[model samples]
Target: MAGTTDSGTGEYGGTGGVAPDRAGPAAAPPAGTAANPGPRRSSWRYIGPGIVVAATGVGAGDLVATLIAGSTFGYTLLWAAIIGCVVKISLAEAAGRWHLATGTTLFEGWRSLGHWTTVYFAVYVVVWGFVYGATAMSSSALPLVALFPEGPGLKTWAVITGLVGLVFVWFNRYAVFEKVMTVLIGMKFLIVMYVAIRVAPRLGDAVAGLVPVLPDGSLLYTLGLIGGVGGTITMAAYGYWVNAKGWTDSRWMKVMRLDNRVAYITTGFFVVAMLIIGAELLHSSQIALTSGDRGLIDLGTILEDRFGVVTAKLFLVGFFATSFGALIGVWHGVSLMFADFVDRFIRERFGVDTEDMVEMVASGQRERSFMFRAYLLWLTFPPIGLLFLDEPFGLVVVYGVLGAFFMPFLALTLIWLLNSGRTPAQWRNGLLSNVMLTAAGLLFVVLCAKQVKDLIW
Candidate 1:
């Protein structure tokens, strides 16, 4: 099926918007056209897909989680961070594979699994967004509101941030939005790298940290480290992004492999950077970060006290970018998924109003799905109530446990789906890939168990 043109007419599709072209030269590029794109040209775009995935994968919460691990256990837990990136990379690649091989939205895949799959996500997205939205804004606000004593209270800043992000997401095309995200992702990398450089770990300790050593009685923190590296509900959003990237058909298998590999490599670097900083500077320190998202704010304060106001400010600025990127990423990516889900639901319920029943192609029907922006609004605003309260332990624990479990769920599913005959033979996982992904799933299961225990006990 790869490298062959389909008989059906094609449409020009991208992160932008889609337009059909039944008779024009814009026919779906013959699978071979994509197959034979010069290596140099293909390479440039490959760099891009990875960046988008990596940028979205890292978030403020992941950083804080790494920081806390460092402060408490130092380099002892570095193995978990390394393990984390591997698991996330495997899971994310699998999601991308599903889209490329199946030509189906992940939502559709989940539905096929059972009504329960749909019900789980339906419940999860809303609850997760409600708590996450306010949390994201407050984390972004921490640096600004803290830096400018006269800035609006956290809630006010949060609202402004939400509205501002909403406007950006609502108005911009995908290309423009993705470019903006890439730039912010660079900023995050710069700040994280700078911190790592400053921390300067002992060569011996750093090497030792890479060797897995389960510290006595600290099984919980070990799992936390593995789970925290780059796991999120966002892991499931990879399929939608790949769709935006124009890799929808099986023709793009080779490119997809290169793309997924690059994406997770970047993800791994982002995680390792945090572990380096934590092990070098923060291990065994008395500085305890509060469990809330606000802990990143406390990190900035610590940075400011030790490195000077400018350093603190830099971390804050990075925090804002990281949190806001997560906001916009969720806004743009997850919303796309949610919108598709809603559109599917509507079509299922109302039979797509015959006039509106234009059959949905792999790339069509995206704009009709408003689940994207609606979710952005939900993620940015409702969580504010939690900000005023104590960040209810029940919900936080719920978020942690669910969040921990999601990566493995995504991985194991992909392992099942992709390893099956469903994916193109060329794109299917080899024995080595299966072994690596299986390990990824096992690692997450361990992490999930730790989280469930923490939540229950």
Candidate 2:
């Protein structure tokens, strides 16, 4: 298993409480064994956790954000989407690194950082769960509302979809969950690719988009594009997926890095294709994309006008798949993060070692097996009430501002933790990791300031 001490290092002096060996609850697979045993799949199964992470992170707001950018700034902000992918890749790799290096859940790492982290996360997860629940379900259900001729209102369908997610995540094992997510991700990718290919812009403009340039009157649009590349609370979920994939030990580090890199490369391509569809089909048409998932609705109209109903419907399927992928993702993944948070500090914090700590928590020796499902249900439903009841401007503003706090929290914590001596000498971050995460921290603080300014007087 990963969290265990390196066989080469005699660092523990063997005074240890259950001597550190393979790190977390799920033991790492033997070093030479391929984790996903199947037909001779050429190294792609390693892509599982990363693809799930990507699908979970990108959502209706993200897609809508892209559509609005394409409508307002055309290909001008394509660079930002790609930049966002780079940022997420860094963060995801760090989260995965912490797991492999420390043999602990991310919550364990956060507790080491300070109680403030645990407390901040606890509060953030709850509030974020409530707000995100309604938004995700409603967004997923919107496409259903459109596609079904006599479909119910989005709220009605939202409630039903939320129920479905709750039940789906309730019973499935890790591999089953990953496979279902893969299928949904594939469908969404096809729809986005179809729109982009059918309506590709002039070759000159497409090449020009490869160059970085900000459009006029689009500062806010540019900021959003940079922020919305493809990441979410699920970036934190990377650790859980790492744990679930039997990649918990440090030996899996190389494959984990490759997986994170390839996954976000796929994400960059996905967002860029959406941008091309917008730039080619809607940029000059003077059709504005209003805020929210409705922006994708605007794209569907442009798609329908340009390529007929089939293509438009394909895009709608893409919207549902992307939105609901995020929905189930939060339902399963974030709940693990939240459960780990509550279970780590609240239940087993008797200066417990990571292995015993996690074993106690996972084996129902702790009180919050129910807490995980509580948060999951919180994420999957309850907030459906808010779907019918409009959230006030103050609430939405608060949600936005609260969200601005997480990126900096993640960036700063990773930089400090990895630099600290607690990290094994070999696993300590190199100059590139330090530079990238530090830059991410500073950029996030600036983004936070901008979000605050936008929200305040």
Candidate 3:
């Protein structure tokens, strides 16, 4: 079912994307001392990628989920939100490990798994990107439209935002992209953290939330909160970000771990802040909002009424920062993914060799590649139509199903890849990793099933 072609620059080695150069066993470094050079760098230096992942992964929907959790169960579910960060930390760390240990992109790692993995991912990015494009733009636009109501309609703002994100990612390299995202994250943290503090979170109640206690009849919501706090397909993109950040060697493992923790710690703070808002604002007032992005708008209105217009506007701006940050992050990170996917697919299906394509991508050269721009267009232009019309019910259902399954897919696959011989032995999963990944896998499976059932029923 494969063919041969001769249309590539001959960078990798063999035809069809095979790098005879890279196919041999990875050079295993001593435990904790592989490719790392020099005395260990300060942990602060390795922080960009995690911020990108955190900014990308936690969007409007996640905040809504956290807000609702706090609104429904008050501070009781706070532990679940923190646990969610821990789970994601394990997943992201495993992903970064694969790239560092194996010296291959995650897509390359997936290809090593089987043709099925490649095919599944190919189908996934296309479908997921199309739907997510509209959703992200819309989410980003909500705050913009809120801020400037008379300027344009939501669809217009969505289109403009999409185009802006497209241009921004289409032109910038990883360094600039990271810098821009950091600034936006700074704005996001200032607004959300400020609001949370202003809400006057109860110290005793928050401390009690650190303990694991579920309120009556709230088990599923608690699980959803724990499982949903700051997860997305973007977690898979973490490794690519790691590679993009020039941390390809295993020597950077320690820094990567610290970076991952800081990323989720930031995420945990945002989630906790939203929970504080929900508990103190909604729970105390016995108010409930509708779910999803609109729920955020409702929350904005509530904030304005209770606090003031300035607070409401600030929160909306934070909402925009979170959403737009995700927009550009996915635009850049996933484009890198799709470009790798395309190059590898060509090699697999058509036998064209690109030689050092992995290096090309990891070095941020792919940001300017034709395939990366094509997928960027694919993510941008096609979804603008969805902003104009209602999303088709069937397509919506399929998107939901695929979205539901992605995290579990990531969890199980990381577990498989890390434990297998494909990875350097020294880089394989530790017992703690195995335990956490298994637990994450099971939790996501249950969550995925529930999502599918909800869609069907």
Candidate 4:
């Protein structure tokens, strides 16, 4: 979560935003200083990390959820989708703000919260990444298998996709990773926009959807759409992306905010486009599709019937881009988090002196470290076996429970950190920020409880 006020020292690294040299009287900026380049860098060029987050966070599951909502209720829950994006903007901004304002990574801040934070994260990443690996690879492979039926089948393609993501993230740095994600997300934008236009949504109905309304029996679905839009653990990873963007100080606050806004806004466009497709094509017909990424394949068949083979194929391509972007994004982002978690745990628990770990990590060395690649491998290989079965029932249940609570954990923790003395006064949450965070926290708590209830019952 990112908190920024127009209150700070003058910009130092030729950046447009004010850069506070010192976070507070008590805290110093993390080590590793780069040569300040001439006149403030353009915010336009600094937009890559948000694109990475937006692309990663809005994966196949998000699209499927939006599609299901739109098909079931037309545009009645469109406001929910929009609200989901807004809530996410708050979370991502807070995460980014914590890093820029404090000059410390979010993981380090989590450590300060206590060993429980460390333990929760450690257990979460290992379990979450393991399950997510199979899920992501299988999602990415679905559209491919659909498009090229004669090619590899689902499990084989999943393995291949996992290996491909592993290789891509293991070998590349943030610059290369950011560029690749930009290209893929741009592909998503073009395809989804083209489909939305083809559907030709009614202007009045779409506008009316901006108003909050609850259709009969849509409470659970409404909450799901509102809480699920482009959200995942990647929200927690935003600060690492900010740091990876080489904006460690508050001077980059303006750019970070712009980047964060553009991210959710772009995500909004994607979700809106999919919702339009569903309402126009499926709602009137009252068609039912399976849940999960495979449901997208059913939609493609419908597109083929109504539109043409070309349109259906194009949608499949966009689907591939969405899933694959997430696979690689997690391959990179979460692995970075895991590396930080390991480094911090070792330093604190083992009493190992790793004074330069922060500097080394900030300077991009961590991305290339063995621990980082090990987690990347963990995300790739161990979950491959899950692709064969329906997936172990017990493990899926556990994944669901943990995944449900992550957002609430993030929202409440940010509220605690931002309001506390640990954060500088100027960067702390004000009235609006507190309200938004609190609302977000409550929303997720209800949604999370619902998720657990649904699973158990």
Candidate 5:
């Protein structure tokens, strides 16, 4: 009841009588206050959460998927990659909008839908985190293993990476986290663009790629490219980052939208650059990359052979940045979501009088909340065992199915929440927003169906 509002004015005025000691210090002055006047313009300087989300979203798997598409279909599916970024921009914007307009976390909005959402998300975060932790660590470890063959083995590096991420996230606040993510993103951008340019992409053909075309037998890759470019649950995490950044109300809406667009535009470049590398370097030679993170290691080896040792080493460093950035991003972002989930669940089920979700976020208590640290540890430690053992086949299937459904779930639910009375009318989705979200929901639904079908059969 703390964050509930009947006025629909989209402003959260107070902390609903929660004790002063529990509320902690407000992490930021309320929007429009003298200490925190809303931005006069949507400046690039306001860009933080978007970069974190983009860097986190485009992990090694995304890069590999885009690379494989280019290797298989050349530049024919390039239009789909660009469209994917556009679609994600809409989704991230919508998520951030919901938070600012409603003065609640996305999980709070999800809980408003039904008890069933609670059930679904409870299972999803647990299973998804367990698997993803191992996966993220392994992905981050691949480049390290490749770079220092004489050093630790894969499992060792994975454990080391996990601990490093945990320590980094545990000790740092949002400000430090954002700074580190930004630095890593810079490394990733430079290396990816360098490779894209160094490949001397056929300018005429790449430009031609802007036009939509589906080559014969290219349907699946086209779909994957569209649905897969820099899309993930972290998109849902964008709002939490917005709140963490101290942009806690509708006044910050313009800044959020600008940040969201810059995020995907950067993501589009990453996807396109990887595509260019796959097309120019691997496709011409009929070389195939092994799927998943190993494929990047393969690309690094190829870069060494073709460019020189320094270039290859730089690419490996970039790969590490991409992987580890995602590792910490999720460690921070999803843990925030999980903390909010537990907070809301306790308040609802046990009738605990907690601070408003916006208050929790803005007061910085959310980051230091017990549930937050618990989930952070959940994301880091249990998965280390997974690194040593083979992931059970059944668990893998569950993870894939849950992962597949998440995007559609996010898109369709946003449509429900934003279009309903829960959000301020001015903040609701417009015609173009509806169209894009509908398209994204359908695309992901198709992708989900295929994934489940493959898992079952």
Candidate 6:
């Protein structure tokens, strides 16, 4: 298994069953073995993790954000949406690169940084997961309630969605999860593009919206458009997905970069398509949308009036796919991260060597680990109460505070880890990577400040 050594030589070393703290330099993978299979060419066939990440990251909230930006500012913020995708591409790429280059999980890297990271992550994951579970379930339930208004109440549907996500993630492995997510994302892509075309967006205006411009009172929306497109804590989970996909070393770097770019490009199209719908349909008529996921339901109602019943139902189906995809994606991806966190904690306490653990992560056995299933259940059950009752103000406030800080946390930590001696010299950040990451870090810091301010006042 790959790991660092006490020697300062920046190369993979063999563990030889030594404890993690005293492991030797990593040895190259055995010749002709799966790990050392020389230089596999990057190809479209190696694109599973990116699809999963993209689907997970662009949930209903992101779509609504893009839609609102369109309704509020027409095509004026289109450039920001595209830039947001570019920023996420850098963040995700850095994460994947760190995993491949260092042969250690992102959580392991964070632990090396300090105890503060552990405290922050522990609080963030617990509080954030609790609130996000209900939020995700409710978002998924909205379309189902709209589709079958006579059948079940909102809380009932929310419970059903949460339970369904639990069962799905608990039973399936990453390969099966990736396939299902791809199908759902495909459904979402087609339905969203279909609506965009049906609304007859002005092509010239969309083309012009690519230019950087900020209209009056557009500051927050512009920042939101740039910062919010397809970004979430799930971006930090990209490395775990990359590891889960069995790309555990630097040899897969090219393929990983290709996958990352494809992921964000797909996300960009989703954002742009929604913007077109909002611009041509809602903006043209000066129609307003309700905030949050309900705004999507409102859009479906408007689509029914403007197009037909068939089109409206189709959009709701797409909305469900988008929302549910995110639910399960988090259920799987974040659970993997939590599993790693727990595994590391146990190893440190017991002075266990992590060589086998690294192998387990690479071979996808982490999906079946005890800690993984425990976290999966935690993400599912406890939050159901929030669907039916008002969220506790204190818990909601904590969730907001943590959620606000996470993007900047991810961006800045990545910058620190990648630029430090922890990563192999050859695999460290290049100029372009540094510039993009720095820009992303700064942008998210501003957004984080605004989010904290909103939560406070």
The ten-residue window of minimal lDDT in model 1 covers 15-24
Residue 205 CA displacement from its true place in model 5, Å:
0.3
Query: Against the true structure, candidate 6 has what lDDT?
Result: 0.84
- Model 6: ten consecutive residues of lowest lDDT: 1-10
| Model 6 error, position 386 (Å) | 1.8
User: What is the lDDT, from 0 to 100, of the residue 293 in candidate 6?
Assistant: 96
lDDT of 4 by residue, 340-363 (tens): 778767766786634456556645
lDDT of 6 by residue, 267-301 (tens): 99999999998998888899999999999999999
Local error of candidate 3 at 180, Å?
0.7
Instruction: Provide the global lDDT of candidate 3 against the true structure.
Output: 0.82
In order, what lDDT does every prediction score? Answer: 0.66, 0.74, 0.82, 0.82, 0.84, 0.84
Decide which is better by TM-score, 1 or 6. 6
Misplaced by over 4 Å in model 6 are 1-32, 35-39, 352-359
The C-alpha stretches of model 1 lying farther than 4 A from their native spots are 1-42, 348-350, 353-368, 384-405
lDDT of 1 by residue, 1-457 (tens): 1122222222333311123321111122334344323232245455455566677667777887787777777777777887777767667767766675555667656665668776777777776777767766776776678777786887788877777887897787667777898898889889878877776667787778888888787787776667666647667787777666656555554566666677666666667777666655566466677786678777777777778888887877887888788777777777777776766666566756222323323334353434555666676556656667788777887776666667777767777776654444555676766877788778778877866887888
Clashing pairs in 1: 133-379, 335-372
Q: Which portions of model 5 miss their true places by more than 4 Å?
A: 1-30, 34-36, 353-360
Angstrom error of the Cα, residue 110, model 6: value is: 0.8
What would the per-residue lDDT of candidate 2 be over residues 1-457, giving only the tens digit for each residue? 1222333221332111112542344333333346423222226557688888878888888777777677677777777888878888888888888776666667767777778887688777877788888988888888898789596887889999999998888777567778998888888888888778888567677667778887677766676677666776788789788777666556567677778887898888788887887777778786777678877777777778878899889888999999999888888888777767765665456644434545544332322356567787787656887887878787777787778898888888888887776566566677778877877788788888888888885
TM-scores for all candidates? 0.84, 0.89, 0.91, 0.93, 0.93, 0.93
- Which stretches in model 4 have alpha-carbon errors above 4 Å? 1-4, 9-42, 353-359
What lDDT is reached at residue 183 by model 4? Answer: 96
